[model samples]
Target: MASDTTNGTRTIKITGKEAMLKNKSYFKTSTGDEAGCAPKKGVVTSKIKGKVYYTAWSMDVKFEGENVVRHMDLMTHNHASMPGNTPTWPYLDEMAVSKEEGPCKDDIKKEKEACKEFTPHKADGPSPCPPDGKPSTKDEADAYADKTAAKECLRARRCQLSPYAPTGKQPGCCPGQTGHHVVEAGSFYNVGRGGSNSTAIEGTANYNADKAPCICVEGCNQYHGTHGLMHTYQSTAALNSGATTQALPLEGGKQTSVVSLTYKQAKTFGVDAVGKSFPESKCEPACLEAQLDAYHNKQGIDDSTQCRSIATGYKGDEAEKAANAAVVARSSRLAAASASAPSGR
Candidate 1:
């Protein structure tokens, strides 16, 4: 087909007039199919007004795809782009709660709001739990009967991923996955398994402490064994690597999510070791040390990475490598913390 700029019309060519597009077949370049859950990445983004915008996808991304899809779609995906949250949980803060805390309150609140929901599937997330968050009904009880679903549901609820193992689990909750949270889940006010350190994770919910997801996983795999993954992943983007929505396919599994940090967000880091220049990232020793331990935990050296977490600002990407890394690292720590499944030993 051709267009005439002046007349607004032009001659057109049709190659498959006699056949359907699918029936034509010759246009096919490859065979493709869509299936499976999407993994939480070290980075994430959304599209806004035809422009690309970056920010945390959802805090409840133990499973990916669904939230990413919701954020990537035409209708739901940012008629806007990133960070335009409502109100804060604590009204307005007089003191910084998270040791890893920085600015970007609106972004943090929005992420916490997003974390309220989750993917309704076996992968990416759990089957939707009760809107009221109760398993008192027979149907609700039955729904939670599925061990995996219960865990995912708890994850969706921002509760502990697993409650008991041979050990206690870190509070795996966070908008930024830091010691502080953008919002509160009952008592998840501003604390993590690591206490109130800059790198501590937001702890699980107070109510679901005895849920099936927490109980079933005990005496087995260390729960939150892969937390290092999300802990770092939810953080990235204070860099130049923000994601491209064109690349974020909702139907696919595990895409290499990324974020593009703004120079403005970068300036928040203040100055570098030389004191004459600003860094592209806001690297906190506590957070950096956590990332290094996560990388060194699994196989070592670390393909896992995170930059400028939500604690600093929502301007980076996250990856799945941290999950695999923490599995092995939990080996020695199992006596203290927990994993969600069998330790794979």
Candidate 2:
């Protein structure tokens, strides 16, 4: 089959019978397939009315076909090359270094800047307890009870209550197996083995010969009997004594006095801030000291770890470490002052 140049007319130059045979397979290829085969990338382009146009277009991803199929296809794969021929994070060092200083240098400088301030915070009282003969009359006893309550409350807030221990046991209440309770029971016989109880009647009242702070309207009602007027705090946060209707004497059990932590102290203690407050209650000296020591010694460090980690990631842990370091260094000065106080131990 041939095309005449003048009018683009197709012609067959052969005998009539041969021409007939040629016409039968005029558009056929060697593989017995049709001519004008489609391109592998699909759809061809054309210039119609002097404007470029496409017969069709595809948006699907380019897939790699077998070598045999690729050879048979008309289109070539230009996209199947290295992805940009370079790593994605090319400027990693620039990103990490941010400024003229490297990350390590910046960290050191940051640490120095953090330590610029040098003034120390004033210390706390020696102990939560008062003078030896402090709690005498009902008013004095109530005051003592209140102080004790505050300290214990602080302790409970700092330490997590152990699930294995009985429910009534306050946080940090487990001070080893010494069997020495924080607040002893009221009965001389130790009748009620666990939980809050007051001192028995036989226990001596330490009211001194000096002027009493307040008058006793009632006798020593340690167990919340009519002998004394009971002081009640109705907050659900408080522990419940067995007797519901009767107000119990200001007995010690459940926490009373709690440690009040500054942002600094909380850091040192490895405290988490999820349940945080502006000024949170915390543990007493003994328990806090133990915790601090555990943080310090557990890792075989010469001094306590500046901050103990409480599952708040690196930022929280680092801050706590700095705070703890400050507290331990300041403890000696505070202790000296405490020793000179009237009721200091």
The models' CA-based lDDT, in order, is 0.23, 0.22
Instruction: In angstroms, give how far residue 329 of model 2 lies from its true place.
Output: 38
Off by over 4 Å in 2: 1-125, 132-134, 148-345
Task: Provide TM-scores for the models.
Answer: 0.18, 0.16
Best by lDDT: 1
What's model 2's TM-score?
0.16
lDDT of 1 by residue, 98-140 (tens): 4234233333343334443444212355324333332344333
Worst window of 10 by summed lDDT in candidate 1: 271-280
Please identify model 1 stretches exceeding 4 Å from their true place.
Answer: 1-49, 54-81, 84-194, 197-345
On the 0 to 100 scale, the lDDT of residue 86 in model 1 is: 12
Instruction: State the lDDT of candidate 2 residue by residue for 174-290, as single tens digits.
Output: 121111111111111122322244231211122111111111111233222111211111111112212122222222332222211121333222222211210122323333223
For model 2, the local distance difference test gives: 0.22
